[model samples]
Target: MTTWRPDVLGDGYEQLELPLGTDPDGEGEISATLVRYQPPSTDLPDRAVLYVHGFTDYFFQQHLAEHFAARGYRFFALDLRKCGRSRAPGHTPHFVTDLSHYDAELDEALRVVREEVGGGVLLAAHSTGGLVLPLWLDRLRRRPGGVAAAGIVGLVLNSPWFDLQGPSYLRNVGTAAVDIVGRLRPRALIPLPKTEAYGRSLQCDGWRYDLDWKPLTGFPVRFGWLRAVRRGQAVLHRGLDIGVPSLILRSGASRFAPRYDASVDTVDAVLDVRQIARWAGCLGNRTTIVPIDGARHDVFLSTPGPLAEAFRELDLWLEWLDGADEADTSGSRTEADDSDDSDDSATVSVLHRLTGEHA
Candidate 1:
């Protein structure tokens, strides 16, 4: 049985625990958590959004869930196996030798969401999570009569790590070396320089988040993990026809050199934003790429101005998805309140703003 508790941030969020269960590999019993938000409603939602966090991160964006909820959508976020709220005493945070191993947990989480919400789901993923989902969906498409392709209506990727960021030679030679090292010492730590620049950009340091959930310092990047990520990236580079509408968001520029400067706040200093923009079209038939100026790697968590613009762009994309305005793909219109009840005023206002409505 899974037990749920309110998140410490007090943002109308809950954390779920999957108690010790038999580890499929006979390693031991495995435990995990599913961070969820069910939008205070008795009736089935019209739609649902499943959010997946990136490497060295967990579900912390409650406002994103509230935004979806006000739009009459149920929202749920998973802290994948061995990550964040799911990390156990013996388990490493965000440590997976192969990305495909996540499919089982993801599939199970989807099943739970489908049972509870009873609507088509939109996948919203960030960074490494963005990389994992598309690859999983592609494999699912190959399966005869797979549920994933049918259940997922759309996709939203935030600064996906599509390719390695360093020089071509490094990626070529380093990846091979990493693979060998992974095979020999999967747990060996390869220290990568850390910077407070990314954290400062989002203003998350002094916030309500628990440092344990998302450390001020990121997790170590091991040879096995990098190799696994590279393998996933290779598959993404090959191309995936997800057959669903997708919205890809990234910073206008990228800076990967090892220097902590103010530019880190305005551009993506972690991954290659240009590569993400270049491959955004490969997602599906109806794909939209929106590059936000002065945005951080995670646009929604950017500074006030850029963050608002990012949300506005997202609202417009949602409007486009609803086919509200064929000519207005930019989602710039204000939303009109169709609901009469004052009790729902706050919810409605949030929904409108999320859908690009001002009022």
Candidate 2:
């Protein structure tokens, strides 16, 4: 991998530009940015993480990197083509007619991580990224033995978008309309109910990210993009056997409001938590679903009380994975932990009470 120069994150982070050929959207000469976090010490032993951001998002979570780096894992994040740092001039920001097209960058990024980081990498993603990685992992399991397939030993999802939010009939009918419109006019904009509640809670007067990229209300929803997301969600609903141990964290409650309220401070003001809890089981066996009491749409970006809880839960899950990996190596792993599964033998655990020292 060629590390030409410094990335947007600067300092310890550097960017590797992957030439992905032509963009199907006709944006021309496509490339994706792989932001690598250089560990302070070259002696840090065998562990790494690859973080994928959601729609209209990029890997800007320094806290997340700190969490993993402190635990001795080299960290990297992908700015998927046409999003964040990878968005070139004349390219439609975060526009993709097919989610499967992302497999190219995702595969390349994983390969680079495995080669550069030199260890089993944990694939962690948030929101729409949560949906994207699971689908990719499911495909990875079916691959004929490759680095991208073998490198990702585990997955940690932050509030995955399993199903569409809003009313049932609307989700059904609206998606149908979106499918038709997307096929006809791929770039057509969907008329959506604008809600700034989640934005107010997250951005809070530019407390965090670059508003131009992330935005206070988020990027506009495109017909083809939503259709692609729905197609992925449908595949998820049909159940995917994503072969590796996974952890999903979400807000236990969701409160959607037109105007800002105190409730938005603690709840998931974006997607429905019930839908996440309902379809999380479809991600195959050996999945742990955690519901943070006061987490926002993104669990890691939650407030102090619940964000700490989310991190603690993540740490606990990481420990469980180490044990599970040891068991697998010793040939003591069970059928539920199989690499390829055709049945709904998933063990979805919800940790309500803090256990052991975690309490």
Candidate 3:
């Protein structure tokens, strides 16, 4: 059983501490945090969404929580071991030798959601998380009593890190380099882009987020970590059958200039959109790909124009999901009075603008 209490992101949210048993990094005992969002007036819902944040990211997107709650989803986001609220002083932030290691926490999080919400779940992931969940889901589908029994109905990926950014040689040869070097010096800091283009796009006053959690430059990338990411990318390039329908969203293009420029606002500064398009089909199940023009790497974080469009696409996908689950769903939503479908855009533009810095 899981005990819930007020979370760090406090307003009507609660946190559950998931014990991850032992740690491979010599950090004493490791654990992860799962944050749940249930509006004050609402009851334990029959519809829920379990979200996973990407590398160097946590669950601070309040508007995203609000968006789902409006559609009658009891939203929850996981802060994986060594990241966000679960980061211990001895732990290297976001460090893992293999992505599969996350299964420990992912399994527990799903169990808790299944027990509390008592209905099917929709997995929503961002960036590296996009890569993590599909692989995890593929494995679950192969299992007889794993998360597959918990009813994960659909998947939504936000600018999934399907492939590495840069020339073909870098993704191929560079990955090999990391593989060897990681064995010798796993914690070595892999050099990152000097330009803070993506940082600039996210740090503006329009989107009030904490710089502490999501730094302007980003956390250091480690050789072992990058190697693990490369391995995941290699697997995705081959192909995967997650066994559930998926929705992938990306910006129209990618901009990799070494220095900051205005293009940062209109294109994905973090990932190559072409890579996303190339690998979107690998997800197997009926996959829907939406490319929003002028969107940022995180479509929901884009400027008003593209931001609104992204939400619209999200609405359409959810509608499709509802139709698919129509046979089993009880079709009950005890939503708050203001939890209307039309609040998507207003939740992005208006509510996010009113968001304050993390205290």
Candidate 4:
């Protein structure tokens, strides 16, 4: 049986530990944590949302949970093994040789959410988690009943890391070098220049959370982790059909800065937004991509103006998803109808209003 206790987020939030028996990375025993928001109101919606945080991050976005809860969803977040509440003394933070190792915890988290909500789920992820979910969902699609049986209705990705950021050589020669070094010394930290621009943008802008869990300078990037991420991106580039439509949100521009500045709050200081747009179509099945103008790497963490615009776009897509479901129920829509030009044009119109660009 699973047990849940009050989470560090305090009132209305609780966490359940998901034990994975042994650590594949030999970091002793390790586990993941599943957090849920239990609102005071008795009435609940049939739908639920499962959120996964990005690299060097945890589920401390209380307002994000509240937003989903306000929409009547039973919101849940997963801190993957050795991340956030799941990290142990001996464990290297967010270290894993292969991304697929996360499957155990993700599978467990989905099961619990399905058992509690007894309805469809919307998978939400950010950055690295964004990359992880699509790969997982593609694997899930090949199962007996596929995503529908798993209760996954759609996906919402916040600035997904679709490709390795930087110049072409990094993805080519650098990847080969990383694979060799990573296999040789899996826990060796990659010597990356220290920067706190992304973290500073959040704290200096009035958002407050535990710095220890999500430090300003961020955690050291392990060679193994980077190798795993690159491998995942390579697979993603090949193409994947997650079996459900996905809504991808990204910033309009990318500005890589070594130090915090006013501009850090206005653009994606972590990743190249163009890469996100380029690889978005690789996700396959009816994908909708929206670039939130003046937004950060994490669109939800952006400033008020862009933040609201991001949410507005998200709501529009959610409404469209619901309409499609309704149409399916009324027997007026078929799988082939998912490619309707009229609906596609309407989506483009929504994008034009949000970003002032054609889809």
**Highest-scoring model, TM-score:** 4
Per residue, candidate 1 scores C-alpha lDDT tens digits across 1-359 of: 55668865465577776544664433456765677776455675767898999987888887788888877678888888878877777776777788888887887777777776677788899999999988887777677765344577777888888888777898899889888998788778987788666765455422345567676557888887788898988877777766566777777677764545667777786787766755655554456666777788877777777778788777777775776333442222322222122323343244344455566
Model 4: CA > 4 A from native: 326-359
lDDT for each residue of candidate 4 in 108-200, tens digit (9 for 90 to 100): 999999999899999999999999999999999899998888999889999999888778986798899999999899888889899988989
Candidates in descending lDDT order: 4, 3, 2, 1
- Name the better of 1 and 2 by TM-score: 2
TM-score versus the correct structure, for each prediction:
0.84, 0.90, 0.88, 0.92
Clash counts for the predictions, in order: 2, 1, 0, 0
Write down the lDDT of every candidate, Cα atoms only. 0.72, 0.79, 0.80, 0.86
| Model 2 ranges with Cα > 4 A deviation | 146-149, 325-359
Ten residues in sequence with the least summed lDDT for candidate 2: 335-344
Q: Candidate 3, residues 17-100: lDDT per residue as tens digits?
A: 998978875567899999998778836669799999998889988888999998889999999998888887888888998899
RMSD of each: 8.7, 4.9, 8.8, 4.6
Error of 2 at 339 (Å): 27
Better of 3 and 4 by lDDT: 4
Model 2 Cα displacement at 178 (Å)? 0.9
Candidate 4 at residue 195, lDDT?
95
